[model samples]
Target chain A: MSPNKLLPLLVLLAVAPAWASEPAPARQKELVHLVRQDCGSCHGMTLQGGLGPSLLPADLRDKPAEGLAATIYYGRPGTPMPPWKQFMSEAEAQWIVDKLMSEFPQ
Target chain B: MKLILSLFLAALLGACATPQPLRGTGDLGLVIERATGHVTLVNTSSRQPYARIAGLGDLSHASAVYSRDGRYAFIFGRDGGLTKIDLLEGKIVKRVIQAGNAIGGSISQDGRIVVAQNYTPGGIKAFDAETLELLAEVPAEYAPGQFSKVVGLADSPGNKFVYALFDGGEIWVTDFSNPRQPTTQRYPAGKQPYDGLVTPDGRYFLAGLFGEDGVAMLDLWQPEKGARKILENYGRGEEKLPVFKMPHLRGWSVAQGKAYLPAIGRHEVLVVDVATWKEVGRIPVRGQPVFVMARPDGRQVWVNFAFPDNGKMDVIDTLAGKVVHAFEPGKGILHMEFTPRGENIWLSARDDHKVLIYDTARFTKQGEIAADSPSGIFFTARAARIGF
Candidate 1:
């Protein structure tokens, strides 16, 4: 194929992975509720901290989003945090991390 | 003038009439609102919240035991605050901070002593049920100044309390026969006894082990025999997943001659023959089971999950030994309580901020009560049961 024809194909491939990484709007809503309520059970309802550590944006500012996502996906061993891979995918975990880093849902 | 005087007298009589108070009949209960650090007094008969009593501190992992009269509830909070609330008046009668951190507690069979299992100071404290006065303190000391957190504290037969030492890997039985100076007997349980519960008949006290694949069962009748491992290697040979939340053995169900228990780090319920203490069957569920409870009739066993799958619940047929039905009553379903006759089942959906009551026979939503992040549901009917 010519250079011009290959350019469009490369662009499409690059955008496809990004599109797949984003969870659907409905799925995002469910993830938000899960983090707010389920995770909120240990980490306070205000994300301030309770039996578990604080999950507020300020406390998590120094933590990278990728590390946070991995923690959510695979869970931290020896801690109360359990693996959520059974319920969500890695991409979805990344999305949750991004939301947590930003303004988390109420 | 005569007609006006008669109307005034009738109005005076109407104003003098006071509302009737709730009498103890094993129909009342409390829903622990974890986030708000309060409990909502609920009338299971009317399926309505009568009152919300606050001031209990750090209820993130709170549990309650009712008085033998079923009129008072002794709530154990995570912050080590033990509050005794009068169910009739819906008020805290006595509150005391007995430790630095605590998980749960139990009442003695004689109804004279209440014990709080601690995580901070690492010991068990016995208090007078009526006065909330500290009667005894037994530190769970394993090494020099090293105390193990206590778990699975349950009232056994003969006014004794049985509990597991999380760090010590031992089960201790404290006889409160004297109340003031209790005698304790310790037995080696498996590694990491996370939680435990006594059977409905108070014959067996089973503790769920987190560091291993099986559970430790203690025969209360034969205390000399010590704790034995039951359902050993139930999670053997499989790549175990991280346990998000520890399976609450308090909700372990016994029905139709079998005990339904949530297998740690697995999406299955292990059904053990209560008579044989052997695994008889395993039922696959949606996710990690949290609360595996049985109806009062022992015909159906209901199971709830942890974290991401906490929204859904499954019903297992005890006779058939299979999951017959699965439904999502609401988000963040925390606890379940069956009515005295098994006519209705009440579930707390913390995310939805409501408690959904279902008709047991048809499994239909009967009613819903507004609550504030409720987690645990306790009914007066539990006061009559063996291990509340």
Candidate 2:
């Protein structure tokens, strides 16, 4: 192969390493957004449970999507948990509820 | 007309009687509650403010005990830091590190030895009262996982041994005559033994029960025998009284042959006759009544309050069994002790990080000392008596 052709190959190999180390930035952004919007004010940074129940995957893994959504919309009585019905639309609640129900303990 | 006059004279004589009812000797132990820690101290006789030294800081949640000579206060810090503070200078003269959580403790009559109980994994750590050196950590008579706190320490009379109480209701009677390898005996009571006080004569060892109302009286004088309960039915009622909470059983004062117990929930201090173990009287007090120190003369009882609220001290005329005066503290007050001369009251204002000094005679604030996390307070008199 010619020297010019070898230069192009080397450039591509160098760029590929950076690409391999890159994370799925969009997914990470979505999780952070969901936590801040849905759980941050009360349960705090990692959903380790603050004023609300611990939302760790280990704690919420067994609950169904309906129950999770209902809790988000209606809220837990006698505690600090308030109904998010006015704060979030049905679809928004469902989206975040789905995320919680899907990946928890971690 | 003569009969009427005689009746009036008799009533007047009763009112003027020297023996006050609630508690006789008003030995005030000032409690200083600080955020990082708490301390207790005795008010010195000098005009200088807050001059007494009791316990140092909130080491391991354990209480401090006065050495035999009243020269040093053996105190345990929150993280296994043991200290021997010079009562005169209020300085940590010696310190030794240990293992696990420490709570309340007791010292031997000779003041040569001190024992602090470890709350978690439950055991007793004996230390040289004067040197603050680790001597031995004796395992108390409790299960491996039992929640333990050293709550009470008392020296039985006849210069015998020192008795320390644990949360799981385990009592360790250790012979302190031998400082290094002390002999110990463990006995179970109920839930948590909050305060252990021996009679002035040292005939009986009374352990104040926190979970329940009455006391578990252990006959240390006759230990081949076991402990028994007097006033077992006390503090219980259909109305559900407020039992003394954390750092339970605040003031257990044995004077004039009576145990003055300030049961917090009931808002009343019950006087129990040690001989019969009966609830003789209930003196109504303000807030969460704790730490009833009898005046040495046995004429009045001084009561103090605890944290989260209720910061005040009340003087109860024992003969009258009524609160004569109430001192509103700017901060929460816990423990207290009278100066050696019995002229002033030193208080541990734990939350304030200051020790409050009160003129016992005038019942006025004299001065206060700034400190860090002061908790247990004590004073020494004539080197013959130790106050805790």
Candidate 3:
């Protein structure tokens, strides 16, 4: 493929990776439980922040959704944030970001 | 004179009579309702909640330490709310907001003072165990204008508070022999000491390193020697998976001369020799471990996992050095506590909102107590333990 044609595809992949797919309802419930209990271990169960940073809507309002999804999918290199790609797809991370930016489920 | 004697005897009998008979605090304990700012006082003997004390602010990751007499429980809240509640009366005696954000707390060896480790102000705050009065503040300011979150606060034998600094990568010891004029000594731990624990004898403090591949150890008997690394390069060639939850190294991790610890980013329990601080063996489990706690008698070590594996719990037989029993107790098992003599073990299943009681010897379900998003299960038995 030509460089010009590849550039737009690269942007598309960067925004939403090729391996993107919305999780099913049952999977979504598991994801919610995972975020609440597992992620809550570092971030407070209230998402008010602990050893890790807060995940409340206000704390995440300023951050970009795609970048947040990337952080969840690939993990922050230096920090304690570990990659979730082993557990969920990149699109599911974006979905989590959207939920965290709004009101997360119980 | 006979009429006066009869009246005095009746008065004495009336003063001693009450509806709800007296009970000792020995069988009492508290369960933290993580979502709600409340705690339920339960009787381990009957497996029933005697009282549910409300109005504690933000107990997301709460922990409690008992007074030497086991009368009052000092609750260290996540929002830095230090509360002293009477186990016998089942009432909040005194409460104080000490800091912005607190991780946990420890009671001094003398039990006269309680100390909290804060993440917001990044320091340790000492309080009077009785009145909840702020006694002293030790800021974890490794450098000017920079504060680091404090973790793993435990009371030592010599009226000392020992803890780890996550951002500063240092372990600190604060001697409260002179509460007003306390002296502190700092030792450089590894990259990130997530949490800490002192040995049962209160001789050594070990910090779990998150940034590196080792555990940091400091001998309280020899503070001048500084902190040293143990189990270095345990995950050298192995690619570490995502550590959904950090491994916790609290009390009762050591049993039968071996220290059982949760390995970070790996589904294994690292066993270490307390005498030499060396990696003795690794017991592979279902997932990354959150709490590797030993029963009171040190015969079996119980471990719970993080995330997907959180529902499973495995018991390690100290004699065999292997997980002899594995079972799915419930969903979201957060914390576990054993009765004073290791007769029964209580586990808090956050998702199910129930505290499941199991007979340690047979691993059979004894009873379950319904709670609101329960997490930590602490018993008055912890009062006798050096680190809780």
The native-contact fractions of the candidates, in order shown, are 0.25, 0.00, 0.64
Q: How well is each residue in B1-388 modelled by candidate 2, as lDDT tens digits?
A: 4465346435433543343334211232333333234343343544332333333333423455555545566666544556766544444587676644454466666666666655443566777665667777666545665445554665654334544444456666776555676677777666556566666665677676655656787777687777877777565654433322232443345667776776634667788887788888888777556577877666678887533234678888777777888877656565676676556777776546566778877888889766543455655442354323
Of candidates 2 and 1, the better by TM-score: 1
| Whole-model lDDT values for every prediction | 0.83, 0.57, 0.87
Give the lDDT of residue B320 in candidate 3: 93
DockQ of 2: 0.03
Model 3 alpha-carbon miss at residue B66, Å: 0.6
Q: By summed lDDT, which 10 consecutive residues of candidate 2 chain B come out lowest? A: B23-32
Candidates 1 onward: DockQ, in order: 0.17, 0.03, 0.50
Top TM-score prediction, candidate number: 3
- Candidate 2 docking quality: incorrect, acceptable, medium or high: incorrect
Task: Please say which candidate is ahead in lDDT: 1 or 2.
Answer: 1
Task: Quote the positional error of residue A70 for candidate 2 in Å.
Answer: 21
Pairing residues by index, what is the TM-score of model 2?
0.64
Angstrom error of the Cα, residue A96, model 3: value is 2.3
Error of 2 at B63 (Å): 4.0
lDDT of 3 by residue, B1-388 (tens): 4455336434533543333467678888989988778888888889887677778998888999999888899998888899999877777899988888889999998889899999998999888887787889899999899999999988898899999999999999999998877899999999989999999988999999999889999999998999999999899868887788888888556788999999998899999999888899999999999999989889999999887789999999999989999999999899999988999999999888789999999889999877778999899988988876
Fnat for candidate 3 (0 to 1) = 0.64
- Mind giving the per-residue lDDT tens digits that candidate 1 earns over B182-210? 99999999988888899988988899998
Candidate 3, after superposition: displacement of residue B79 in Å? 1.7
The better-scoring model by TM-score among 2 and 3 is 3
Best by DockQ: 3
